[model samples]
Target chain A: MGRFHRHTDGTVHEHEHPDVRHDVGDHTGYRESGTVRVEVLENLLAENDRVAAANRLDLERAGVRCVNLMSSPGAGKTTLLRRTITALSGTLQLGVLEGDIATSLDADELASLGAPVSLVNTSAGFGGECHLDAVMVRSGLGRLALSDLDLLVVENVGNLVCPAEFDVGEDARAMVYAVTEGEEKPLKYPVMFRAADVIVVNKVDLLPHLDFRMDRFLGHLRDVNPHARVIHASARTGEGVDEWCAWLLHVHGTPTQRG
Target chain B: MCQAIVDTVTAHASGRQVRRVTVRIGHLRQVVPDSLSFAWEVLTEGTELAGSELVVEHVPAVVECAACGERTTLDWPVLVCAACGAVDVRLVSGEEFQIASMDVAEEVP
Candidate 1:
């Protein structure tokens, strides 16, 4: 059989293939003969995963359990981390890797908590990356002495989408979901909601002032992730901070990679 | 994701002009094919893959129900099993994001 030239309309013809490009067409089954198909068969996230595994091993060797905290903007991730730092101070050696797009405001707030904090401003050199990948976390990891800390909380950039896509060598992933964000978020952004090991429903104190329904939110969340542990909390009023802190303590003590 | 594809293709192509790069993206990955192709073009402009094509193979989200013993492919992002509508289903597939293969121009003797 001669080499076939495929068209954008899903038609193929046996003829001499031209150098005409089809960048704007739907790339369904376009194939040619002069080109040799090389089977790479590699996961695009393989590079990120390899770095994440190395970061995990490094943290494990240091006897530190890391948690990746993610959420949408204004979901109170920083507030919860601040409260958690205050609640767990002196009891647990806490270290924070604060991720933000352009500002040090979050890092500034965490610095007063008396724990070692490493701020990873994505805008500095990362071309304003929306989420912190393993490479970014590794760059931040160097600033913190892992051996000196019992827990490392990576405050992923406040993005429910891209943050969930990248793994930064964390033992567990916690998502701070505010009640005001709407019940349909789980269904709308299932990737982020499903990736969470624990979903902290923040701003529950304002539940009375809003039209948010806990039952509906839980129902939707269950549809996406039935196994994620849900915790009702308010970072502003310090409610449920103890429960959140206790969960962190428990996760820190547990060996994440025993199997 | 586009950046990852370019890097992978570049590494595998190894100085050869890339004719086409094939990638398999699961529905759960939430990648829009058009946006990916646009990004690919933007990233490949002026590079060896300038006029190269990006072939996208979309993988649907499939789940196996634990209670009903059924495997269903979902059209939406919801993870519920379509057979028995059970939420206690494990993901069978749909988290894939990989470069399957690439076509490079054959060397002329």
Candidate 2:
């Protein structure tokens, strides 16, 4: 049985039920259960790592920077991608792979920005899969030639949880959050934050009109990810979008051209 | 336990809980079975596969002699065997990430 416990130190731990033992054996004899813990000489993620490395190598060889964009529903992922396309279109031609449970709405939004976008619908036949895999993304890439694009942004299904686990050959994985979400998000869900390289707190133009506390949100974000850069902006008013785009160009597109 | 590792990782895993986790290590991979199991338990503490168990297997590499057709299993990456000083040896298997089947539990309709 799995039992959850909170110690006085406030650290939470789940306990494993010890296997049953036999008392029929002598001091040095054999036992029925709780056998010696076998040393597992296995790298659990061994398979995925190989595929991820290959994906990265392919991206580098093609000179295409792949970025995985993750967020919750209505966290402004497509909106952010649209703004990113418009902002970086001058120097960096962008492509988008929009993963959704259903519909082409997100893909449509991206195409309206004049960006080459592909929508991967994983509605039912995918066995209720929540996130996109490298193989799936690779197949999507096959339809587009990398020579024409500088950046390929994968707007993963609007989920803060599962997308953190799978890698889609992106040079980096970034998380998106909005002011409407509570500050406790990072604490309530840490897996996504742990995997993020950048954190975009969108819809910040509503900060003055909402109960969002910038200090609290920053503290929580820092607690989970101390190194990830956070950009506060309104995808609507394009407030800090320029700075965000500048950072992206520095990391993925063209940096030396910046003034 | 494999289940524990699966459970702890399932929350983070988007596709499926890994069914069979295989590992490959070189003598120089500096990976110890105990340490690996310890890391697995520590990492798999509180996920969807808490109750599952682990299967650990070792892959001993075979190196071929450049001068002679000698096949040796006790070969290291720096295989300057005491028998032959030939620095050219083709390896047959025995690399890391031997993880084979992920074997996610089939979803019921």
Candidate 3:
């Protein structure tokens, strides 16, 4: 017969073989055995989720609605952010947290527009993680004036795969998919598409130059994320910026009409 | 991600030599198992977990319709209900990322 012991630390040690020692040595009353089954049913991302939950509570307490924006590289996320900041500067107080593997070039650009921005260079720590987890977002939050801001936007490191897995405690998750990237992106990177609450099809101005089909793209997006609000935009010509800004205002529960 | 795994293994299986480690990953997690395995090999080169086998179990995503209560094991990216065609569906499983158990070679005293 095998012996089973429960430790105060919540670890269960089970000795399945007769040759295994119930009490060989050590203060824990369990010794080196033939094969010990240590049941550790713990999530690997539990720590991250805990930190994310705290971040959510912190943002909620400050009455700041946070949005996490994720997309592939060269998806016009920074351009969209710049336009949104310029459009909503007078209507709502906005702050941005920009995440990058290296360089604060995007942050500097946003700051030039007179927007409050914080830069999180992941290359500085965690070995340049491709995704911005909750801990990194919390570090960025420390540098921003949360009390003075009504909306906080976190532009996640430009990657479709890893960023979708980590939740940074944002009230809404949005993604930008430029039409130049092709219509097959929604299916190719389904996780990011599925996780998004809103998806913006940027670079509509280039639609005439490219073979991107609107119906096929929307069909793929709807198949993966039926509830995601899809907005067609052209950051270069300021097309769809009004509707996008209106959606943002609506999400923030503020009056959509400008004074 | 590799560093997190090393820390977790060191914390739980301290004294013993980890021969193999099993992890259960959900489909919705977007973790590439092959990439993870490669990362494990690179990260554990000089550590105690060197040469340890990394076993992975993938769990398929399951979504439950909020409107019709239809459950489905999703093969594709489509999250809508198969039974009711309802757009309002909640994921019930497939976000799991956990260290299920480890097979360690105990040091004979």
Candidate 4:
């Protein structure tokens, strides 16, 4: 159906293979030993792996545990953070980086709680910025007192999908989804919930008032990530805060609140 | 070219009310497709790219050996042939970074 070329005796030989014959010297560097060719199939993710390695090293060196918290806008992320800060303030010196498209409200809330919080206001709306990368996190980290903090929680711009894909040199990725968001959230955003090390079903205090069903919500979460631990809590009330705090301590290997 | 594609796609995305988008970036450029995908996911949410899908088509380079008449396709740049371990080879194809496709859906009215 198309024109191609190849070599033939006395006649124009149509192209048999458009694929170029590789030079044995540099292209392959393949040393053929008794008909056996061996070349390592290195993944393109090598760069990300290298950066991740460096990030892990950086986190270890700082002696600061970083938590990347993701959730929907009104999923009670700030509320949960507020609750956590209040509970952990006396024990752990916590710092935060609040990412928002164009607002300082989240940072203001944290600051009011007497926690060190920095605001990252992105103009992604103009150029179409998607997610925060390691570079952005590093810049925000530079603004914080990395030496003095026991934990640095990066509250990503609320939206479950994109925040899950980024690696901000955090010790672990956690998610806080409010019960009011609906039970089908985990099913729709399986990738995000699956990526999380732990899932917090916040605003349990509203269970009696809202039509939210816990069984279905939890079932979807388990189907998505069988290993991810779930925490039920209300940032407004003091219920389940101790269990959440205990889990944090166990994960970070400190006492009650520091972890 | 890169900015143009991004801008066009972003505009297309905003018009359709896409929350997130995935693009398959072939295995050629230094751009880690994950970074772009991650960027696409976060940057789009709450606006137009809220739930858009990004599927990066990573085209692996194919190589053919001149000495042993060996041919193979691979995802990464493997200079030596895994079959014959010959140094003499040619890259048959690769070095392409294109949107394999886009994932789009109608916005709720």
Candidate 5:
């Protein structure tokens, strides 16, 4: 007899195969083919894309432009977000969906800025995915008041590899690369750099103390993403914050430019 | 990732035990095939797909340029056209992550 077990989650598993004597022409007066081939041309991420479509519709209906921000750990993505929020909060409404492997520290920090913030901790479930896929972003959307905000930014989990794979219904994709991370990052993590619509080179204040070559970095970046707008900024010093804000406003189609 | 693979196998094979699965992943998808295979071995221990082979095929990234009508394969992410240097290029492929086919041991009814 075939041994079968059902888990509480409703997944069925066949534990052991049943032994039976079978002749070639025993069943239905035809020979049994023990092996079969089935063609299934279906994308594994299709389900996630379906949810992402719904998320896109929701954001569109609310007139909220969402940006998915990705980068490696300690790249100052949160700091750049804080500076962006502080620079534009006076003229534009903003909301944040902070993604992390664990802890609500980033969300808590953004919340201090008085902007509506929601936390999506992948570690709670979803196997602590290093990237924020569309399904996760859809779930995070439910926690935010989309109608109250003109723009929503999803700070993806700090990783360069997997984050670029999943699309989270974002109007734009941006990434921050800190100077301290070195210049060869563009080639090492080409997918992340290539997927980004905007690339911000952060921590320019420390460039004088480091051996980072801007030319090599830009060369690699241009080779990977020829169309991405490059911006240099120092979140700590507030340098290039206005230019970045202007670019954001321009891309968002908002007429108001920061004075 | 294993869950998705298991679901696909179960849906296609039904009561049959899966023998092997072939998946086509694109360059831009960022999935490490070795890691996926390792995870599959661990996750399918008690399932019907146990001992099944996981085969991965990588697809190259291709982009079609609107200006020059050039379709070229890109090793990296150069969105611009090589001929005319136009940035008006649309991605033709390289984002795929799909189960192309499966081999299963069919039960003789």
Candidate 6:
């Protein structure tokens, strides 16, 4: 018998067994058995998780806090980073691990900000991988001197899906959600929203011209992740960038117990 | 994810011919079964594990309510309790993503 749990009504709910197929095999009496069952119980993402844990340990040992920033394409992640870099200039030592599918476009933009920036391009893969996994971040760390930085912001590839699924050994996860992406985004992409520790609702400066409802969007976000710290900002207008920088300072100051 | 599975299967099989690969995937992982199967086929093609059956056992997301102490199997992605409607609920089991086992041909002496 597999694992069983009791409901509030006293009914025992037996966990579904994948081995049921063997008992319900074809009634036709035919047995060609030369195979043995090998128990290889392991998480499929163990490799990635292991690498992420190692990366976290290395970062922590070097006394650096890392944050993974994610968002959809054109959601102003780069712009927010630019604003944040400017706002936190000289206040804290910072470095950026800019991840992109191809090209050095975003890296070039951040390089001009006078901060150490390492670019990790995944264009070698088939059409380039959508997200930056732990291995990629580990490789990017090679070019960066972790001891010199107080915080490392990994600007993940512009992807809301796969980026949330992969842990890049960051102390926290922040995402940029633009108001132009529609109010139903939180409901549609619950996983990404739920994974974020901080969510920045960017492009609030365009609120007067767009038909986007902030209330509905926030309501959906609340439904998906009530605990996420949300900040309404406009990377273009330099609005709410201070609060974002404050949060970064907070993360940098706090001793992270995460691995 | 498929690539991960393939790498795991290859490492575990170790000179043996795999017949079936069984994996337990949680609903919260948001992996589509059909897409995983297709990816498995594509990834395993021309490899040692080619033609092996990939069995995906979906695990439903279940949360234990903190206030009411009721375990609710969630149909949706919302983390609220079904009985008490409380948002403070601890997830019991839904984030699982593992390779449970595999059926491999016995070694020829």
Q: Indicate whether candidate 4 or candidate 6 has the larger TM-score.
A: 6
lDDT of 5 by residue, A96-141 (tens): 9999999998999999998899899999887898989998998899
* Clashes in predicted model 1: 0
The deviation in Å at residue A182 for candidate 1 is 1.2
How far off is model 1, as Cα RMSD? 6.7
The candidate scoring highest on DockQ is: 3
Which numbered prediction scores highest in TM-score against the true structure?
Answer: 3
DockQ of 3: 0.58
Give the per-residue lDDT digits (tens) of candidate 3, residues B1-109. 6567777877888767777788899887777899999999999999889998888899898989999888988887777787888878898888889988777765454
lDDT order of candidates, best first?
1, 6, 3, 5, 2, 4
How many angstroms is residue B12 displaced in model 5 relative to the true structure, after the best TM-score fit?
Answer: 2.7
What is the DockQ score, from 0 to 1, of model 4? 0.03
lDDT of 4 by residue, A34-124 (tens): 1111111223333334565576567668787888888888888888888888888777788888887776888998999998887777654
Interface RMSD of each: 5.3, 16.3, 2.8, 22.8, 3.8, 5.5
Better of 2 and 5 by TM-score: 5
**Model 4 iRMSD vs. native:** 22.8
User: Where in model 3 is the C-alpha error above 4 Å?
Assistant: A1-3, A19-33, B65-71, B80-89, B105-109
lDDT of 6 by residue, A41-135 (tens): 88988899999999999999999999999999999999999888887888888899999999998999988998799999988653489999999
Candidate 1 lDDT over residue span A153-185, tens digit each: 999998879999999999999999999899899
What TM-score does structure 4 among the candidates reach?
0.60
For model 2, what share of native contacts is present? Answer: 0.07
B1-109 in candidate 5: lDDT tens per residue? 6678878777767676678899999877768899999988998889878889999989988888999899888776556666677778888898889998776665454
Give the TM-score comparing model 3 with the true structure, all chains together: 0.90
Order by DockQ, highest first = 3, 1, 5, 6, 2, 4
Cα deviation at B34, candidate 4, in Å, is 18
**C-alpha lDDT of residue A9 in model 5:** 41
- How far is A220's C-alpha from truth in model 3 (Å)? 0.7
Scoring each candidate complex against the real one, what DockQ results? Answer: 0.53, 0.05, 0.58, 0.03, 0.52, 0.45
Report, to 2 decimal places, the DockQ of model 1.
0.53
| TM-score of each model, in listed order | 0.89, 0.61, 0.90, 0.60, 0.85, 0.89
